[model samples]
Target: MKKQQGLSVIAILLVLALVGAGLMLVFKIVPVYTEYGDVKNALTALSAETNVGEQTLRQEFDGKANVSGVTSVKGENLMVVAGAGSNYLRAKYQREVPLFGNVSLLFHFDTQAGQPPAQ
Candidate 1:
């Protein structure tokens, strides 16, 4: 008789469990990253505009954030930097996402408009 050519029942169940865990992580983590994108877009847009006051920048970011459904970084968290020839908007924040019981993921986000993204 030929040897078993496919996964055993136990092996299949283990694979399924691993796949389920991966899917759960993706579902939980993707939304947070999406919100980060929204935050970055808001910063980029604000940085492109000509604004003199930090308060104006923050207010503009808040409006964009509200429309974008971004909750990770708020307008109050933004920093206004005056560069040589232009002004930039930056946001630095961290998020703690709870996984299963006591296990959580920590994410650090720092974004500066008019500059390359942080790696």
Candidate 2:
């Protein structure tokens, strides 16, 4: 009986551990996907904005939006940039790990090309 009880406890603990990991991935990784999804929708709006090709499109727009977990904090610039002579849009972003260790989500939008980046 004692051995059975111990095994049961261990099994329960294992299950809990698995659940915790799932939650962490859900909470952490899901947001990244969610933010990216929003950015994806935004990209649909940007197809006409590109004077170059899809390579440039992906380079300049797709996977290039500067996004984080929360708002009101400074983050890296992950914008897709267009270069000269077949230079297409490319993903570009700045990586800024919080010094204070506070994670923030920020989204940067470059509304106009060949102009100053806004937000």
Candidate 3:
């Protein structure tokens, strides 16, 4: 019997299917993470601002989130915690992405920004 030198049709199909699934996942998940990064940077900038109040922070965050297309968490959802000598801004949210049929992927993000200069 002669040995087959290349991949069979079944093997090629299976490999292609896996690659397609992986690419699909990347396409679906990359946007969410990109938005998360935007939100994080916005929060960090807000934290760094001096003399900015909660209301101002919320307004800024809302604008930034809108521009960044971050729908997972809104400015109203941000938690402003006051510590002994500093304050912190926290955002916690989740994103659900539909994959194949009823299958879905869930991503949870929790990010915090502390006062730029903690005294």
Candidate 4:
């Protein structure tokens, strides 16, 4: 009897299916992270600037979000933390992405200015 070579048909199909699923997940999650980056940048920019009132911060964040095309977290979602010298902007939100029939993925994002992004 001849020895089996490389990957069999079943193995190849299984590998392909796994790869496809991984690709789909990446494709679905990448955009959310991209938007999160935008949100972080906006908050950092706002924080670096002069300290302002909470309402002003919200308005500023809204403008920045609009310009940066960040739709995941809006200005209203931001929480302004007033400090003595500078202000901190915190954004906490959740995103639900439907993968396949009745299956969904949930992502929780918590980002703050002058700090690192949270998962």
Best lDDT among the predictions, by candidate number? 4
Error of 1 at 12 (Å): 1.0
lDDT of 3 by residue, 14-119 (tens): 9999999899989999998998999899888777666667777888899998988888998899987544444578898998988878999999999989853345
Which regions of candidate 3 fall more than 4 Å away from where they truly are? 81-87, 115-119
* Candidates, ranked, lDDT: 4, 3, 1, 2
- Model 4 pairs in collision: none
Worst 10-residue lDDT window, candidate 4: 110-119
| Inter-residue clash pairs, candidate 3 | none
Which candidate number maximizes TM-score?
3
Residue 112's lDDT within candidate 2 is 27
lDDT of 1 at 11: 95
Candidate order, TM-score descending: 3, 1, 4, 2
Q: What lDDT score goes with residue 119 in model 3?
A: 50
Two-way lDDT contest, 1 vs 3, winner: 3
Q: Across residues 1-119, which tens digit of lDDT does each residue of candidate 4 receive? A: 99877998999999999999999999999988988998988888888766577788889899988987887788888888655467788999998889999999999999888543333
User: Against the unseen true structure, what C-alpha lDDT does each candidate score?
Assistant: 0.82, 0.44, 0.84, 0.84
> Could you tell me how far off, in angstroms, the CA of residue 13 lies in candidate 2 after the best superposition?
1.2
Question: Model 2: per-residue lDDT, tens digit, 1-119?
Answer: 35433457788999999998687655765555565455544444454463565455654442344442432212223344443432212223322223224864444433223432335
Comparison by TM-score, 1 against 4, better one: 1
TM-score of every candidate relative to the true structure: 0.85, 0.41, 0.86, 0.82
